[model samples]
Target: MIEVDEVCKSFTVRRRSGRLRRSRTLVGAVDRISFTVAAGEFVGYLGPNGAGKSTTIKMLTGILTPTSGRVRVSGLDPSRQRTALARRIGVVFGQRTTLWWDLPLRDSLTLVRHLYRVERSTHQARLAELTELLELGAFLDTPVRQLSLGQRMRGDLAAALVHDPELLVLDEPTIGLDVISKATVRAFLTRLNTERGTTILLTTHDLGDVERLCRRVMVIDHGRLAYDGSLPRLRAALDADRILIVDLARAAPPIEVDGARVVRTDGPRQWLAIPPSGNAAAVVAAVAARHEVEDISLREPGIEDLITRLYGGGVPADR
Candidate 1:
């Protein structure tokens, strides 16, 4: 569904060097990154601030041309065939709304139908389905300006899907949404991908979304592809450690264990970093022998912890 081959994007920006002097420097937003997304697959694109995630999305959506290399979506070059590609892809930006501010939700959807040149009957059928699926019937007649953040987001999702695009590109789709709204959106997306076979490429700072939705993930750092694989492989490749929170019967020094190291200590509780392959029983026994143990629990490494480790230059060369 999407392919990026050694793509690079750079921009020239001016910086003040002196009272009357400005220096122009070239900045690389995406630097020779290569990856592919097959049809019917859901992939997560992850990176921290200024890590070229948005730049890559913009290129894929034809908002910006790459400074070097190639970008193709649905077998067409996004830069040269943007108009044709638009019909096959849907984009939702959490920070921006596609609906007209003063228009009611119904009117905005009608405009979309016209813009996409969807048949009257087809548009009506699809709108009805999306309205039901996204639960937009409650605010169908409400002005977009009057809708709450969650309401506005649901309305945006409906607008993006009305055209029946083959690919859905989402950027921070759950940002600022309440817990219930986020769950609703996530469930809808899962159904869309599984039942409708719509390929998805999601980029978000929310690890919860990735943990629930993405089986495959790609991490980009400094505009380069640092890791590309399943979540399990990522954890193994980075040698991520499991966390053990042990609460002793009384305040004591950090627990001494051979396979685990105390990473944090607070009162009677101590957090230990146990190797992914380490024996939890052995660590617990080792701690219990030395401390007056009261409670103990194990937590597997989360996506956030793994990504933080990867971003800190711990990514394996082959991952």
Candidate 2:
């Protein structure tokens, strides 16, 4: 469980002017963002670059202090009780590694276990489970530097979980991973959340990660919370228009469907944006009856498009 109440974080960076004059400028990395994650919930935090997602995560994980407001992880204030809170949370940053480069994967995990003061038997048991679940046995003896990106990511994830933390904070966990490797990581996370009931807060640029792994999502933009709710709700709210692609037997003149606007035209194929209130089945029937159609397909807007629209200042309206 995690609770963040109107948390705000800002950074003062040095700005240089002409003639070598310098001044400090305060930039808000996170601006009064608030959300809560219940136990066993896998929530996706998503936004474009510099959207304050990482800032919020750092504040919750105790890596950075907030300028104002409050954050509590498992009933402990991370800033004031960092050590106690650290033991109850696991963090994996896709851009960084927690393991020492020269250390073998097993050795890194062993070190983490000792640092967390995990009992030997408990450590061994957890390690075994993680190794099997993460398929780390293939390269357990490989040094961190020698492993491939995928292997290193798995090693980092295993290290984070060795102490059995209740909450997992993952920032771009699947970045730069190949398809197979991404699937493996997602499968492991699915099992972890389903079986162990670990609360997971994942920040990712990959909408596929959110689609596959999270039922709920929180979108942030311009250092503020833009949207927070079930993924389906967000999708419905942003994508009220459906796309209808119809291919006629031959090239047809431009024509419009009632309550639908022509969005694209290519020879015989025409794409129309149909209002959600319009009957798609009736539209398709009308097209088929009026024209010699070869094929037709209906598509809803994708999550990525919705995110883009949200960042582009589109108003949120229900489908």
Candidate 3:
């Protein structure tokens, strides 16, 4: 439902020099990035701060023009047919609200219905469903400024979908939300993608959101696409070593296990890095034979760690 072909976007940023001298430089925010999203797929666009994620989203939503290349959302060129494309897409920016601040939640939704030219009956039905699903009935009459952060976010989401757009572009939709609120938002988004077949492109710093909701993820760094594919594939590619942490009942002599490296040792606990090709069972057996084992746990590197390594310009360590 979304196709971006070698899209490039740059901003002219002003730089100040000594003695009040100024210089204008073109900072490339998105450079030659290309990807396609199929209908009904929920994809996560992930990166660190200033990794061009927001720039790409803005270009896709027609909020900013690209310096070169092409972008199409739902078969329409966003820059060329912005108004027409807007009707086919819904965008929720976490730090910004599209709803009228002075209007009640219900009134704002009504205004959006009129703005979208939705039929009265269709509007009412959609509103009713959204109100029930989003649990917005309690504060339907509350002004935007009076609602809590979580409530405001839910209301924004509802407003974005009032016209039933085919595609949803959510930028940091769950940022700064409490755990319960985050779970609620994630559940709603999952339902929207699974039940309604809404094409969703999400940009989030929260790795848990990506891990739980997105099957496909695209990682960007330094204005370029670093990785794009199934989340499992990315994880497998980055984490080639399985880690085992063993806690002993008492400190024992330094032990050696074939094909495993001793990564760290602290008192009675030892950390071992097992290569992907190595047999973890053999290593465990060896450790068990030598040490008084109290407990053992295996872990793999998390997505957050992989992302940090990617942006930090270090190769992802093998699992």
- What TM-score fits each model? 0.93, 0.90, 0.88
**Residue 75, model 3, lDDT:** 95
Better of 1 and 3 by lDDT: 1
Model 3 stretches astray by more than 4 angstroms: 247-260, 265-270, 277-296, 309-319
The top-ranked prediction according to TM-score is 1
Tell me the lDDT of candidate 1: 0.91
- Candidate 3 lDDT over residue span 157-239, tens digit each: 99999999999999999988899889989999999999999999999999889989998989988888888887777766665
Q: For candidate 2, list the clashing residue pairs, or say none.
A: none
Clashing pairs in 3: 239-319, 240-318, 240-319, 241-318, 241-319
- Model 1: ten consecutive residues of lowest lDDT: 310-319
Candidate 1 local lDDT, 1-319, one digit each (tens):
9999999999999999999999999999999988989999999999888999999999999999999999999999998999899898999998999999999999999999898889999998999888888889999999999999999999999988888999999989999999999999999999999999999999999988998999789988888888898988898888889999999999887777799999999998999999988999899888888888899999999878887889885575463
Write one digit per residue (lDDT tens) for candidate 2, span 159-268.
99988999999999999999999999999999999999998999998877998999888888889888888877876677568889989899988656676778889999
